[model samples]
Target: MDQFDWKQLLNPEFYILLELGGIKIGLYVVLFIVFAETGLLAGFFLPGDSLLFLCGIYSEALMKEFSTGSDFLNVTFLAASISVMGILGNMLGYWFGSKSGTYLYKREDSFFFKKKYLFQSKDFFEKYGGKAVVFARFLPIFRTFAPVIAGIVAMDKKKFMFYNILGSILWSYVMIFAGHYLHKLFLSQFNIDLTHYIEFIVIGIVLVTTIPVLMKLLKKKA
Candidate 1:
């Protein structure tokens, strides 16, 4: 791999992975991004799914940054850590929505805020009700706003938390483990290194996750 390029900092893939400025805090950065992406409205553009997948690919290395655990333990720790961040993020988002009420709807759109995304989340929440908390976990923008929407409508707290915990674990573990095991499988069986193809992998994950969101938005427009 080439030396970490400053220019790559502008790229979401590198940014989310904390490959900038020779920073070794990949784990902390990943956790914070997970939290922001799930909890903060401005974090809608952050690369949540791709970040999780990349973390999987780099699981062992990331673990070594903090521990000498076995491979399985490393991946589990990474996934569990990320899951906790995601859960907390959703809780914060819910709290924000519950306290803010209709303020978000009336708030003007800035560079980081888009009213359409909020409305889309609203539609998704209305259509799926409580299930949106779970379903939105896989979708990009929806995942960021679903909890907030639930909070806005004052959805039952216990029910919201049940779905929140369920969704966070499912989403985090699936993405992270898929990356970890797939990377191991390909390297061991096919002699292929996924790190070299990280860009393509990131792009593929983004498209797969975002296409549904785009289609939903388009369908609504039509």
Candidate 2:
């Protein structure tokens, strides 16, 4: 790749790890970010949706760059890897909730800590039950916290696992492959690179998915 291509690839909008040197650090960075976002309480602010989708689009670039006949970055590998990362992230989140999340309500709110987010997540989990695992996957913030709430409520492990696996597969495939195909289609049909505008597209997606929850919260606050 040329210097311009390298600059674009390293752009924070395209790849999450701007300081990590190159896309060769793909799977590790993707998995670690997903796991932290879904598992840790402090990770609620991470850009889960954008990262996954952008990673998918970048995976195509990586595949082309590293194409050694059949040794390219396989699409199935990318999808499955992301799905597994999501599943494990939720599992870890649930574990953390089961261990200490219930007592968190007692802790006084402080810097970087907001009880309202937890309460909102709890309300959603209670309203949706096991289905939240699947539904929250599409919604930002909720996707990371729903599993934590589930564990705090001591929900059935089997049920959580089932939906966790299902949701992970569905969300990962949809977001990742959507970016992949959108990039491909735009390049082929319109000769326009969707990648240039991917950050904006991701913002739109985040807003569309989370607006309902935001409105509900606003109404409740009123």
Candidate 3:
């Protein structure tokens, strides 16, 4: 048996603080997560919608300034911007996977990167078609690597890019806006900074949103 350090596991509260910090830092983390998750296997677990939603919810609380989305870097615009980041990340992932999968893997491994989960993601991409690009954006444990795998398998580049852009924007914006509007609808009671809850809650929703897959994983592990 191996001893797993629990502290190594992501602390949900860290994400909460990131959310409560406001737009600039919040958006920075969101963009980083989106880019890294799709850009490289090593970053698959980085926070996404949970943080983004929190950003939307708590945009007023942060201590920085920026201008982008609706009425001053609103969630809509934040989502849209990060969506582009995700797409670009996927593009880089694809190129890396297609042209230098092994070399890239080896290089990353030299730095202690683990990609055990990405194998499953690759299989999912194989089983599904280009739809994986769009739909995978909403699936945990699969969304991060599906596009990269598409490149490994030599999926059509132009077509993959189209789906990639559409899905990245749709997924990123959907989660951020959902948090924004949902909180706006109930600010009196449920009001909290969206980012504070999003990096974890939104991710939980995305994961739970595809419960069947999770159940299968649980069953397999069992």
lDDT, candidates in the order shown: 0.85, 0.76, 0.66
Candidate 1 residue 65 C-alpha distance from true site, Å: 3.3
Question: How high is the lDDT of residue 35 in model 3?
Answer: 84
- For model 2, the stretches where C-alpha displacement exceeds 4 angstroms are 1-23, 62-73, 110-112
Output candidate 2 Cα RMSD: 4.4
lDDT, candidate 2, equals 0.76
Q: Which candidate achieves the best lDDT against the true structure?
A: 1
lDDT of 1 by residue, 1-222 (tens): 767576664344564456456766778777888898867764677777888888888887677776645888888888999889989999999999999959999999887788888998999999999999989989988988998999999999999999999999999899999999999999999999999998898789989998998888789779
Q: Model 3 lDDT vs. the true structure?
A: 0.66
lDDT of 3 by residue, 1-222 (tens): 446556533543344345333333544655666788778654545555455556556554432355443444555566677788888888988887788766544543333255655676766676678988888887765777787778778988899999999998888777767666777776667766444453467557656656856775687689
Give the poorly placed runs of model 1, Cα more than 4 Å off: 1-23
Measured against the true structure, the TM-scores of the candidates, in listed sequence, are 0.92, 0.84, 0.74
Worst 10 residues of 3 by lDDT: 15-24
lDDT of 2 at 215: 97
lDDT score for candidate 1 against the true structure: 0.85
Q: Each candidate: how many clashes?
A: 0, 0, 11
Q: Compared with the true structure, what per-residue lDDT tens digits does model 2 show for residues 188-222? A: 99999877796687777778777888898998889
